[model samples]
Target: MSLATSPATAATETRETQRWAYPALLALMALAIGISASPAPLYGLYADEWHFAPITTTVVFSAYAVAALVSVLVVGSISDRFGRRRVLLTAVATLIAGLVVFMTAGGVAALLVARVLHGFAVGAIVVAGSAALLDLRPAEGAATGKRTGVAFNIGITIAVVGTAVDAQYGPSPLVAPYAALAVLTALGLVAVILMRETHRDGRAVALHIARPRVPASIAADFSFSALGVMASWSVLGVFLSLVPGIASRAAGTDNLVFGGGVVAVMAAFAGVSQLLAVRVPAKRAAITGDFGTAAALLITVAAVDAGGRWEIVAAAAILGFFFGLAFGSSLRHLGQVVPAAHRGEVMSAFYVLAYLAMAVPTVLAGWAATTWSADSVFTPFMVAVALACLLAGGLGLRVPRLTPDAVPAH
Candidate 1:
């Protein structure tokens, strides 16, 4: 008999690849997201080297969020029609281009371009990659979605800490992180190439890209969840974009590694809280995140006034834990209500609000820092966050509570 493989063997091999694709996609998601945050710790260095304003630093940070907002609004659901593999490949290629720009960037303009490219890549990956993960998930509903949250927290933590370590000790602090990330991303590209396509064969939608809209039935539920995301992510946006400068200002030091570690501390606590969220009710979890963030803001102000590094760390840890609980639980609640067929578009709509919260408030904080003083920034955000949390809690009471049977799985 000929030793050539039979069609049945080939089909079995294909099935095995598909089975592993779920975890493979999760790994790629972590890598892609991690690389996206690598540059954050170095923004201070860029300012020092290039002599840009503190506001310019915020501009650089907000550039990614804004581009992501626009990208998600426009092409967020495109993978629903085009298939996930094609969209993911495009994301990887764009990310590589962004990394190349980062490697060679000489000015803030180049940094902006790189960040915008990075944002575009992340936007597509967040929507398409997440949808693919959901499609390939071994389980359904909140259980599967928690895996995404855990993956995200893990990725961000790596990026923040890795950049810190490389910048503090390595030669060419700015260049080295990007170079290493480029290699990782290259390997991720190969992983994407081998991944099985999750999209079913179907007629393509006439309009591949459109503004994401919430359906009428899910609108109220979406609003509550959106508020939770907005409140939670807005606090995270503060830490991601402004906390480094704020912490440095408070501590009277410019140690790059310390700043990066502060950011990592925030995410580290967040990752821990996400693990604990499994036991908490989603509504109580949302409220806890909101109220907890408001409480953290107060602690942060005390920490800043006290000028104790350990206190600052304590504040960040508190905020991070609540941020994790709030954001993840909000997402879990939404996943239970949003229909499977419209998952891409609906999640895109939710992200639009979330990213907008991330960018706009941070930009305004930056503007306030410039027009007023660096010291003036966190107080207003603190007030806004507290008020938003209060509102989220009130709204939380009005929304229908989630149960497993509320959403029928396919």
Candidate 2:
């Protein structure tokens, strides 16, 4: 005879699954974002091996952002309507495919294709996986936010450092990193499969390209926060896309460890800053992000001019601190203003603005480097980031805090 399961046992099993789901999603998020940066240190090697110009490197790099932008605009909300589990699984599978293509890339065309695949995967995971984390997090303090930053930073550090080590010491640098990423993606796929479905909205909803809409009530606050994010993310985009290669050239060495270490230092500090920001007041965090990044830019200019390895490393860490403060604080403030009903839209818009800022500035810098030199690009961008910081910080202090409407904070 078939026996009925007891209610207590079922509840216990549910609790156990809930406990594991939170960390599982965190791991999945870390792995997805980490893999996104895996190709950074290898860009210089590709340029050298293929005899491509610096512009080609930017093209390959920008391709990822461009494709990610499209995915965010179009399919970002798919998981909200469908189940998060399916979307996350698809995202991991796509990441795996991207890694395979990346491993066997023979030309720029293939590389671009791989990055496009990665972009789509990143877009989906960033939206779905992040929401999943929030859903699985316990009803307590803002622990979800802290874990989000930590997971991303640590994951990126591992991917970049691991790839760099592989590139530096492995038999085949180009193939080695991608192989590692392939394994990571496979593991992420399994984790995603095991994750419980957190999103309950399985009803179909119409999908369209997401656009940013700022109500007059919160326009100033939104503008200030968006500007802060733009300034910080632009700096990050530069490091991710170009600094690895430039740091190698500046240090007069092609050691993969050197390039990867620069990024790892920045990412580690950024993560740490985010963890610390939880205790600091929101406005203070924003202030720090603004001026801190501005100061870091100055150091970056000096590091490049002097061609000192340690200086670049120092600059990267400082810049990361500012990035963490600005990005994390702005997002925290945004959470205060945006109503629960509209959180998805507003967050998506924020991401679009931030990504655009990141891509456009980096592209312009790339073109400037082509016209003049990398140093020339750095000097002018430093001025711009500093000016932006002053403006964002000044306005951020003035803008009043936005109180959420009747709706809850999602």
Candidate 3:
């Protein structure tokens, strides 16, 4: 029964297994990312259709983040017990339901509900899809780690770009983008059904819900990394929520494609930066990239205040590149610090921080826009984010590196 008795047969089986696992996991991640980004381009359209103000639109978006927060707190570890495939299926089903609600959205209430459901779907996907990837790692090779990194980058990039393009130019503002997502979710569900389950037997007996725990050994490491991630994501939240509004008012670019193109360009550059990070040390790349992000955000603030369209666009592109590098580095650092058993839980914590960062700043920015000019609002926001980035970078420099043996086995 052992592979040593028949090395060739074992090798063939290993390759075949990976052949299915990696692609399946990548598809799941991409679908999640796609759904997450789908709503960004349509916010302006929804504002007109729902007759809501900027604050209302931001609330609608924040509702998704709120739901994701709840999901992470309640069911984030469900896959650890129920199995990754089962939870993944449930997540996809929720996504389809969310899309349905989105396509049928009427008033702000309906939009809020749709976004909440979408957030739940994203939370579930982040936990389950990541666990599935870890479970599907190659049976006997170092290649699995590198491949997993690549898969993560590709999946998120595809999702961001796909959502941006569809929302911008697909068709009707409300119906077309969501309907397209529903189809993609369905396709992903089918793919999941065809793929083999990665985690089968070792289901935990505890059915009671509990809070996520970060082991002490990894806590300091996680904290340092999470701060950087939070700073970057906060910038992203503001960009996603208010940049379109700024573009319309300052540049008079009312087209959906133009607005979405700004985000798409940022995401594309981030994706490119992530692919490049494989050649560099994660820590070094993160520090360098974070500094770049702070610089870009400052440039963007200046451009926004000056009403320079091209400058804003260039700043966004550079910001996107740096953010991409920061994201890949953070995830890779987490992979290094956390053990496989606690991977899902740790990632859930990381994402909870990220989503909170994504939600809160936008809500505050929306409020600020009501009282102040976009430039005035962006000034303080940029100042706050820059300060946070500096703090993170300073802390990162002080934290000692953890050897593999130093990382906890559990």
Q: Which one wins on TM-score?
A: 2
For model 2, state the Cα shift of residue 88 in Å. Answer: 1.0
Query: Candidate 1 — which residues are off by over 4 angstroms?
Result: 1-15, 74-77, 215-219, 339-345, 400-410
Clash pairs (backbone) in predicted model 1: none
CA lDDT of each prediction against the hidden true structure:
0.78, 0.80, 0.72
Candidate 3 clash pair list: none
lDDT of 1 by residue, 102-206 (tens): 989999999999999989898788778877776665356356567777887788888888887888889989788888888888988988898767665455655
Candidate 3 lDDT, 219-338, residue by residue in tens: 867877888899988887776676766765566777666666677667777777877886777777777777777887788777777777787678778888888777677666666778
lDDT of 3 at 337: 75
State in Å the error of residue 93, model 1: 1.7
Ranking by TM-score: 2, 1, 3
Model 2, runs deviating above 4 Å? 1-15, 138-141, 403-410
lDDT of 2 by residue, 1-410 (tens): 12465534543454466787777778878888888888888888898789876667777777888888887776656776776788888888999899889888899999989989999988888777777766654363277877887899999899999999999899999998889788877887887776667765335767666776766667787888899998988887788878887888888888989999899998999899999887777766887788888888888778877898888898888888888888888787777777666666777778888888877888888888878876567778877988898889898878875663222344
List the pairs of residues colliding in candidate 2. Answer: none
Between candidates 1 and 2, the one scoring higher on lDDT is 2
TM-score for each of the candidates: 0.90, 0.92, 0.85
